[model samples]
Target: MKKSVTILFAFIISQFQAQPGNYYQQSAKYKMNIDVDAEKFTYQGEQTLEYTNNSPDELKVVYFHLYWNAFKPNSMMDQRVSGQGKNGDSRLQKDGVSRLASIPKNEEGSQNIHWIKQNGKELKFEIQETIMKVYLAESIKPNSTTTFTMDWDAVIPQQIRRSGRNNREGVDMTMTQWYPKIAEYDYDGWATFDYIGREFHAPFADFEVAIKINKDYVIGAGGILENPQGVKGYESKPLLSIDKNNKVTWRWTAKNILDFAWSADKDYKVKSFDVPEGPKVFLVYQQNNKTKAWEEAQPYVTKYFQIMNSHFGKYIYPTYTFIQGGDGGMEYGMCTMILGEAQNIKDLMGLMAHEGAHSWYQQMLATNESMRPWMDEGFTSYAEGYTMHQLFPEDLPNPFIKTLDSYRAFIKKGIEEPAVWLGDHHDNGSAYTYASYVKGELYLVQLGYIMGEQKLAEVLKQYYDQWSMRHPSDRDFLHIAQKVSGMDLKWFHNYWINTTKTIDYGIKDIKYDTKSTTIILINKGQVPMPIDFSVMTTDKKIITYQIPLNMTHTWKDKDMYGDFSTMPYWPWTQKEYTLTIPYTKSQLYVLGIDFSQRIADINMSDNFIEVK
Candidate 1:
């Protein structure tokens, strides 16, 4: 008993020693009250935020994000639309007629000002240019607390992107991010940037929003509605209480969130269901002819929730709203704005699942999106693909759940591109989008293959648990992955994240002697990925091994032996590598390089070698 107790104590000590803490350690708590008049598409809100400055450096200024400014004409975001055509291209001509209309800058506007007593004096402040850097009268000491108040207004723009104004027959509004908000600050400082067509990262806080809208309209927002009394018999009072013309004010509050958004529509049909331990899934679709398709999509959405919660982690929020929006789906905290019209049920489900997964990556694990968009968008895309394959295995061509069919199609069509590229590259827009989404996901899939799923899942969970509300860079993610996988993946990271290299490993030659056999592996492509060689004998026995060729040990090594034979390792430099295996002449029948087809081996036909 004493020996066992000693061993247990030592194990506990080792675990404590190995625990990592530098990723994300701070938590934020805030309170907000929002009042909205839906007819005019104007909202006013007060946010009482309590921020804990956990970093070592003292903070002197706070930054808030004015995201709605992106919709204004001639803004940086508008320049993207103007420079690139409406679909993000400059050469295409406008088609004039569409459901979403582009609003001029003069029509769309937002104002945010704070009045506070700082250092025993009253100070008035106003914000412009999307991100406001407010200088505090007194410095917020490190590891201390501070309270601040903000008053802001948003004039909704015409429905162009995901957040806008529209009065369709079956939909009244699909408002999202239609508010003046604050950016996030962490060890890396404030995340303030002009709105771009990518992802979002916000600081976690509490929200209390009150919205006044037409009595005929049903509202869905980011948080739980606190006033059940107001909702009951809401349509009775036409002139005073709740009327078609007069606005009915509804109050909402959400705790432990980063942002607030809401939607309202008179023709909205609502369906509510609960997950086992997750948030209540609310499916909000148009009450018109689309109800049948929305109803058919419920089971798939529920399956996604189940699979995601079981695989990644539990849904942390209490309620999740899926409302009809424009073009594609966009994710917000606790609420996901999506377009529910799809000819194929599978496509709709896939879109919903992808956006829902973003709730964890972008909404929960709030990494600095402007700097490292891939950490959120890329990872979420990969997770979405995995969830789709898991739920619909028939769509996959292989038993390994790698979706060999889609991968082969992408390769054969010459659509493959490097995963690492600048966000504003001057390539074909379709190619850039493909590389950013598809190839980025492929990179994660390759990472999964490098480290088994169990280890990869553990790393992903740890990443969320540690950096959920913090800003993490690409290096941070790579470090955590290496620590969790117990593998030095610097080569993988360097070649995949920093360069545009392709992977091609094949069987160069095979030699058989009376006593032993030897196989030579060649690096045919520019990139060097860890090779998984499979050796099958005439007797039907198989042996598998991994070859580690990283940047550090790319040169030829004469002394090393065993699983990783003596060979020169070069990353995007050397063309070929030779490996000798010890097997009897009769024992070796065929040898294959990267036999599992896990790596994105660009060339595969030359991967097999036969021994006679």
Candidate 2:
């Protein structure tokens, strides 16, 4: 009986360590054929969607995102940007006027769907700017597969946002979100969001795409190019083309990806190099004097992939491209669109590191950006900081000082919103960035403070390993963290993500007798956390102590800085913690709280005291 009970306990522990299997996310398969007129800045497309309904409930309706429609004059995305006024995204504004509204009507973006069919039966559909809602001809049954086919064409708008033609950097076409992408439907039902201005979310799928365009242009995309011999720099020699219009049809295929985006340029110079133990790194940009930095950025970006592959889990994609395009830098599935005219290597490589790190959190982990952007953007930002820490030398106490700096600056305004707010529903753009990127990165650093830094590292590896292809929400990640740390972190998640509560722990008072020194730690902020403080004695010995939160039910076995003694648990209800050190007043030099600066304490003035 004893052996049987032990086996049962081991089984329970193994279940928590393994990937739990109830998230039945629907999957999609895409087959698209696109023909483009480079001069007209337009394209015609035929798309076939093979969708599987994995849910228990039958689907009555479905939707797709015509993302390019957001670039129209009076579209929902334009209105959302125009409404921000003074706080609008600077990229979408020029001297406070909406660039989207100023686009020429002929040059404006439009997607006119010719027809749609469900399983060879005609289905009714309505286009409301960027979102397409389709009334199903027949209710899709649970655990069933269905096919939807559509024919559409669009006049690509002049560059205003992520997907457009002829961006500010002189790239010919930054083609992203230029297709009729099907909306993701998971346990939360239809994630049919209006194109308001952030990123997107989609399920993993296979793509077989063929783009026909003028032979003069060079193309780069997320998928592996099938017939690349004739395309510019993709293969060693040119292959014969049978078309009479001086056009080449670039065939490409990608397996198990979320989205497909591509770019075409008349002067695009493509360089393909293999990262040792990483993906085949491709640097696609227009070579000019201004793009000298693009060449220098290769080694730095190569090292980033190696570091991420070693530090995090292996990068799932076989090829990763750093293509030159977009307003600034935007991350896609296996490639990133970055502006190419930068003159310096540091700035250019810095941009690539941040966007490239998105492969892990944004593309692979595949969180819904609209709902749980913190898990995507914030996690990517953390990976970026680590990459920069490796690629360049930062003379700081820790790698997260920039995030801490941003967090410190943003908290002072008191205009911060709860991170739980949806990506597009922020009070302003700056607030969204702070809440998503800054606060999100700070979440990991603070977790290192709560859970040991070693444990946080363990959590990252396990998270990437288990949730790479799965659409993990905040709860799913927290579950992995709890399993790794052996602690309940709901209180930590509640305060940091669910509320605008700040953290400010301080050394309130200190006193000493002949045998021991008494120190009082006070929690001035609403959010309470496990404390790691240090004391430098007059005897010149630096001593540290860690006080675990009562809710944690366990303490960190090691510390990042040095060795520390485990003190009693600080109950969340208690505002003050008294610590006694076996040192006299004459032997103490100074007492400080969280001297390593890992915690995001809003105030630092009272965290230290000179023990005279």
Candidate 3:
């Protein structure tokens, strides 16, 4: 009996680590053919899915995401937006009211699955709003593969959300989540979060898609154009003649992408910029004055790819399409849909940098966003901040000061949910948005402050190389950081992510003599963080002092600023700590805590003391 129990325990542990090379995720291959009706604003699709079960559990049922169903009147997304009152999404509101509540039936979006078959046999299935569960006739054994064939018809919603038609920008269609997408199956089982107009998560797969549309419409999609010569926008490659019905079929293919998206319009002008050792950046938009900004942004976008590739991991795809479609910017597999109209080239470049950064954080890393949104949006925001700083260099010591301020604002509101809260189920939309985008982004910045910026950069590159194709959790990243920085970061994760604690450190007291000055630092807030203390002398030279948290048990090796003298670790139990510097009291002009503004200290006014 003892031996049997031990064997069972071993078996369970083995099943948990079943993925290939200890970083396993399920793989999918999709072959889809879509027929679009430009006049009616609808499409018919046929999909063949080949899914491999990399998990150890046997599959009795498979799920697919019917995301368009969320756009209907009184749907979950509509109701959520309506319930949020004025604090809800501005795009979903029209005339100071919820526009989704009044959408016309013809304009409403939906995917109606006609039939689903497993292998050669039809299967029993049920549609649960945004999720469709299909029961398999034969259970898929562990380490096996299954094929699912589906036929569906979908209506293009009248440009209300991510997947829509005739956006405000006048783009004819934005084809995102327009298909019966397969839901991700991981160690957490099926991820079938209802589409509440917040976040999306999916398994990475190879896509082969053929879109048939009116010959007049030009196409921009996520993947590579398999037959660019047959498409209109891809010039000077000659276009193939339209079919008998005045429609043309455009073929596209992408490998190891999370999802497939495409947009079509009658007036899109295509411009391509080639980046050395990176993807050919394609900017597609309607010809207008706004397009000039996009044109001016060509060199900046090229530089973005170059910096991101060298700093982060390399971008695998050879092409990336940036289309002027949708309410705002949204990232797809190898492309991004961004609103074209910008005030200037700089604003457009900022938007493009944020969305382009998603190509690495969201598209490549592919974290389970609904579960851990910060890993997706937060990491991307961090990259966006860095990219912007590099693109438009300012004299500010810390370029990520805005991100840190945003986090402080969220904390001051006193409505912040734990960063670990489910992406769609937060108490309010502000909590979800701020927690995911702002706090998540600040996590990296503050971490860089804690563990030296140079070390953080190394860890980020190593993380991207190891976990690009695999979804990584907060703990996974912390583990990587711990290994790289030789520091214990478990307390950092628990305090920052799992709780709503804030960090506040102030100068409690100061004493000085002829040869040395002593400053008392107090941790008044619930959260704890490493301190980067600095002192400015009357001679205009800055003397730096570093304090490592007792929890870390290790100090950051190097920082972006000049080297600093090490101080004792601040213990969490002890509220106040004293540090005595070699500078005399009369020689110091100002004593500041975190003068770089990297730490998210709630009460900033008390962080600095003026020498009298």
* True-structure lDDT of candidate 1: 0.65
Summarize candidate 3's per-residue lDDT along 1-612 as a digit string, tens digits. 999999999998887676533655788999999999999998899999999987778889999999999887889888888887667777887544788888898888889999999897999899998899999988888789889899999998988887698888789999998899889987777999999877788888999999999999999998889888887988787668689989999999999999999999999999898999999888889989866788788788889998999998899898998999998989999999999999888899888999999989988888888899888888998899888999999888698887777777777788888889898788676888788888888888888889988999999998998888888877778889999999998888888888888889999999988899988989999988889899999998998889988998999878987688888788889999999998897899999998788898888989999898
Off by over 4 Å in 3: 1-23, 94-96
Candidate 2 residue spans exceeding 4 A from truth: 1-21, 240-242, 538-540, 610-612
Find the 10 residues in a row with the least total lDDT in model 2.
Answer: 14-23
Q: What TM-score would you give candidate 3 relative to the actual structure?
A: 0.96
Candidate of highest TM-score: 3
Q: Candidate 2, TM-score vs. the true structure?
A: 0.94
lDDT order of candidates, best first? 3, 2, 1
For 186-236, candidate 2 gives per-residue lDDT tens digits of: 878788888888879988899999999998889988879888886656877
Candidate 1 lDDT by residue in tens digits, 1-612: 999999999999867654554433344555555566766777676666667776666787777676766666666665655555544532222542222124555446555454543444444445556676677877878788877766666677666566667723235566666655656666556766666445566777777666667666777776787774575222343333565646677778787766777777776766778777667877777755654567777677778888887777667888888878644677787887777766677777778778888888777776565565566667778778777877767643233335433555565666444545545442444555555665666667777666655667787887777666555667777888888777777877777656656677777777677777676777767666666676888998767666655643332221111232333343446566555667876788878875556667766688777767
